[model samples]
Target: MERLITYKLPKFGFPRLLAIIGCWAYLALPSQADISLTFGTYAADKPTETVRKYRPFLSFLEIELSKALGEAVSIKMVIAKEYEHSIDQLANGEVDFSRFGPASYVLATKKNPDVEIIAMESQKGQKRFKGVIAVHEESEINDLSELAGHSFAFGDELSTIGRYLSQALLLSAGISGADLQTYEFLGRHDRVGTAVGSERFTAGALKESTFKKLVKSGVPIRELTTFDNVTKPWLASSTLAPHVVEAMRHIMLEEANASAVKQIAKHGFLEGDDADYQLVRDAMEDSQSF
Candidate 1:
């Protein structure tokens, strides 16, 4: 296994380490609860810097959830500047709930085995997603194998289709992450596409819907193509009880409620089981074997 476990460093030292490990073991024993939830996101910008400008869609997320829950929920939205840190926070119970891509969710489950996936997103009601290796229309790269030594941009290391899928494709094509001349994290899909189009990166990964949205908004569709494709979907995290999971799942399937979630991330939550996320688990195992 890749052993993508997340650990917390106690403020004291060795004694606290033993205690924390023991506590984790105890929590892994499993319990149930009905409690107010706090949600976290990997989207918030840095703390000490000016916010990364974006559309006002986030306000709608807060508003819609509040309406659905019929109470003020504590949403501790923060930027996941580092993927490991995001998983660590979730593992330590610093955040009770979160959303993650396929790779991050798998990594998180390793550390917090009790963590439950609560929801998943889809596009046009389709949960299957793919990774795309895109370049400018005038660029020379035409295939995943041709990307060697070329500069690239990844959305985030924890991204399912963003980085992991693209990397898997590259590795399958006999290229390694180290073979890249340079690579950068543009943070989000839009920036990744924009960076590639502006020549900051020779090629990059993009979700299919993001590409379509860009084109629909008047960006040139001829700017990119699929060098490779990998399927991924949205996932939710919860350390709550099964009843809670079942409740949320039921609420998410309500057509009006589902529509609101879909508007937030281009996909709505759907009923899922352990098998629904097996692709991510399998990919993680395969990546670690390398």
Candidate 2:
């Protein structure tokens, strides 16, 4: 005959069982806050226009990030009145992530050591992009040397291509700020292009992409010369969760997502690090006036 003895199961108090259930519930809840991506006014367009231009790409990023992270994500267009403000937003945690021109990233790193470069923009399959000095197609000014004594326009003073690289090129040609009859900051690349195209300014400096785009759109301007390449970067606040950052990096590098990236006027994105922007730091240190 089988043994008749049977063991009794342990029982927990009501309070203990409730505690266990509560712990399980906590584990099942979502673990992250919504993400915020901030961008500066890189063009002359109004804030609404800037938002409109970026909406498609931002929407794509939002959807992908949410899907990957299992949490909601959102874009917060900071629309910085000045380029420096964008850097400030990233450094101070006003935004979780941001896209910075090379010089701005360098300056932001200086201001806030917590700034990190995670990815860079690529266009035409090249990770590097150049700055350009532009003038009216019919302008008599034919060379950087001729820019002396002529009124000049610049985009944001903190702009890498629009101001710093442009300043460096001018310095190489012996045209210092004092050499210009006058110089003004128009606050955006498109404004600089429009100002130069209309002959409102003798010359201006802007990103090669912006210059080319303006020309393609029938703006009457020509590139006077090109400057050294600057590595454009997408930066994240160090305070961001590691997983969130990795998710963004992954999305950016995914070849299948190239179409989404193209909405931002880029061929794609590449892994980037702070060291990649050392040249920008060197350029900024060398040209402080801009």
Candidate 3:
């Protein structure tokens, strides 16, 4: 008589074998979790212009961040024909992150609550800059109040120093919207400076950096005056993954700490948070009051 043979299959049947194989396959795949970061900057120059042309005055934060992240990063230069269009792109997540002036950041955040404040440029222990209005030496405009009822020029309506800050300053001086007979957005800061210099506008407002550059380029400063100083220059963006954000912070700090980066960025951007932007946001609120 043949002995009854005992045959025991493994506890895991074919289904279990398939499950094990799937798990192993998943583990072997490459992780695409690393963020695909995109960055943009306000183009104070022409859209067609190469960013390399103004490398001296331009911020290289994007390049620095790309190096720090240990991954590929794309930097898109934006020359917004209208401030609204730029803000709309950012709100819809067409752009992952950006470095915006105070006014532009406010407009973007108003549309998308997901944007986050990551960092800002600072000097003398302050993270603020202002809008300065000026014109050619020949122009008679002397003060913010004097701009009323005159042809006013702005760089970009979304510009913190160009439009919002300048407008806020005008309002503070009791200049009402109806007081201005004409307003123009020249699109670029250089154009704003040139227009004011060429007598195209009675006065114009721009970031101090741009103003300084124009002056350096031989635009006479005698033509311009500080019509208003409403907000500071701040950097901001939409929220990113914690690890990604940390990676960014680490890169900035490390780069800044190195003497070489200081040469590239002119100055290192300081660590910043939502609170650092509060003052900027408050100034923006004040701007709306006008």
Candidate 4:
């Protein structure tokens, strides 16, 4: 009879076998299994309040995105201490997406050209919003010129309305930073409003929406001047998969998501691009305070 030979494969330890199987299983899984989107925003109010306001909307977003993607899409919010920090997180891919003030978006684009504006906030069906310089209703300050030789508060140093645009307004009124008696950054629009209303600040700069909300809530502040309108943008890192970005854009534009969008923006959202915020970038370049 012809000679026959048999070969035996080496046996692996149980733990080793499990580890090898786990590696292969992980590698074999769909890319979505490893995907999670982190959204970042500069603190527009108290950090906890800001997170509270956006968490429900983010949950809604997660559900919608999961349905669209046919996978368990995870979403989380990161609250940055300031606008520049938010931009930094977006630029370095620490956050996959972000909501930005017009000026912050400009700064982020400068830091990372791959950052893209995917959508913009809208109010009362309008795509633009303005900033305001306000003082206690009883303060003697009447115009930007009157702010000279008086203490002033700005919401955040990198704020579009609270700094750059408001500075432009002051410059137009022929008052430069050197012209002010003293100025300080109060960090948030609510803080600026509260400080000005309490007469702690001679005047303050903040977004018009915050000013209106504060006034409606009996803050006793009045707008001294308003800045030119600027477009706020929702930005995404280019590192995100194209399909993921597209899904976000589509969901934001959907009529069904309007209410959810309103929790963050009074109006909703509109499709937008980098060009929409070029004016903000130009303004920053033109401002000395920036």
Candidate 5:
């Protein structure tokens, strides 16, 4: 019987037999699934510039997640065309995760309370940052109170610093939308800066980073007021697996220190709390009347 079976089996050399056994072993082992995630955000800048600024961070995150999980990982970036659309996408579970500004974060939670904050962006371990109301360098509008009856520029309507917080500041100074002779939501920080710089608008509100960038690029804009604002928060969808959210949170807090992407949050991330956004909520409430 043994002799008959040997004859029936194809002749195999020692190396070939070992190779067959190895193949069988590999086949028998269970496969580890690849981790694929989609990251979402709004293009507060130009779409191409937003992609350029975010691609490196996504690549870095994928490499780190792969190493930490012992499996291949990939993160795809989805940039929304507008701020409100980005909020809608997150609330509707169109993406796995997102990085939302404070105002948009508040709005997203309102739309879907299940949205989870994974981490908040930090600046050198600090969780607070600055927003600026900018005016053309030669403009006589030296104060927020001077904005009355002058054309004002704003970024996306949902922008934290550019709209909500800036509006709060203007309200504090006794100015309202009707107080301005003209105002427009230009849809981007760069546009707001350029509008003010080109003398199209008398003053504009934008994040401090964008204000500095425009000034450095010779846009001839200067800060009229600088106000404190909460940093951005990274959020995960409620529909995402809990394990994946935990793993992503861990990776962001642990692996982001090695990230060299200076265009975004350079210092890494910190644990976030809903209470951290109370100021934005307050500002939003105050802005409703404006």
Candidate 6:
């Protein structure tokens, strides 16, 4: 038989007892109250520049979240190599939060129904933005109909304004990809604008902001037509804590100010619903036949 074992509590002197009590008290407290989160996105421009532009916004999120949650909050920004990569990260619950274009948000939800929309970006006080199909200033091709025989440049295959909506615009003109002499996905709005401005391609499509920026920089491009696009939607990973989601939603919807977050969504955010992207969904579905 195993020997019976018994132990007696250690007798503590005054100093030792105080130290022992203090150690027990420290161990009994919650280990950590700080909250750490990951924010994911795909770069629409140079990755370095994208990170630079977003760091401040991420810091603002941390500050606001901390204030709302009554804990130290930190958010690490993660920029994926491409759109689909970021979408996968969000849809797979690999990241705590992410911002996505309308088309990407739709694609993510299609991929993982559990993904949730937290808010929609509000630009200039409206939850709407613009995309443009542009051509060289002197190009005689004056309309979407005129793009039939010309080569074209497009932004990322997954970019909302760059690919789907722009392609839908072409389809509405009764033009199809087969009608174009050649077309390629250049993967960035600025690149599409540059390709069109340099006459490398007869035409291209990109966001209105990028088109305006390129034109202002003497890129010599002109918007042939403009199309309305819904603003981007912010998403939360399915596995994120409900309390954290609530905190994030509160900060984004009520506390965001220009001085703090003036990145792509300059005016902050508004409550978003999946139905808000119906137009983009239609465009995405329609463009699939192309």
Per-candidate Cα lDDT values, in order, are 0.62, 0.80, 0.64, 0.83, 0.88, 0.88
Residues 1-290, model 4: lDDT tens digits: 99899888579999998999999998898766435889999887889988888898888889888899988888878898878788899988899998888888888877898997778887667767778889999987777788788888987888888787777777878888799888898889999999999999899898887899999999999989887766678889868888988898898888887778787777888889777777777667667752
The TM-score between candidate 1 and the true structure equals 0.67
Every model's TM-score: 0.67, 0.82, 0.72, 0.86, 0.86, 0.88
lDDT of 1 by residue, 184-278 (tens): 87777777777777778888887876766665775543334453332233334545546545555555566766555554555655655556677
Tens-digit lDDT track of model 2 for 185-226: 888788999999999999998877678889999999998888
Instruction: Name the better of 1 and 2 by TM-score.
Output: 2
Q: How would you encode candidate 3's per-residue C-alpha lDDT over 7-47 as one tens digit per residue?
A: 98678888889999999999999865343554555565665
Instruction: Give the Å error, residue 200, model 2.
Output: 2.6
Model 6 misplaced regions, further than 4 Å: 1-33, 255-259
| Candidate 6 similarity to native, TM-score | 0.88
lDDT score for candidate 5 against the true structure: 0.88
Which model scores highest in TM-score?
A: 6
Residues 151-183 of candidate 5 have per-residue lDDT tens digits of 999898889988999988899999999999999
Supply the TM-score for candidate 3: 0.72
lDDT of prediction 1: 0.62
- Which 10 residues in a row give candidate 2 its minimum summed lDDT? 36-45
lDDT of 6 at 288: 88
lDDT, residue 209, model 1: 63
What is the lDDT for 177 in model 6?
95
Considering lDDT, which of the candidate structures 2 and 3 is the better prediction for this target?
2
For candidate 2, what's the RMSD? 7.7
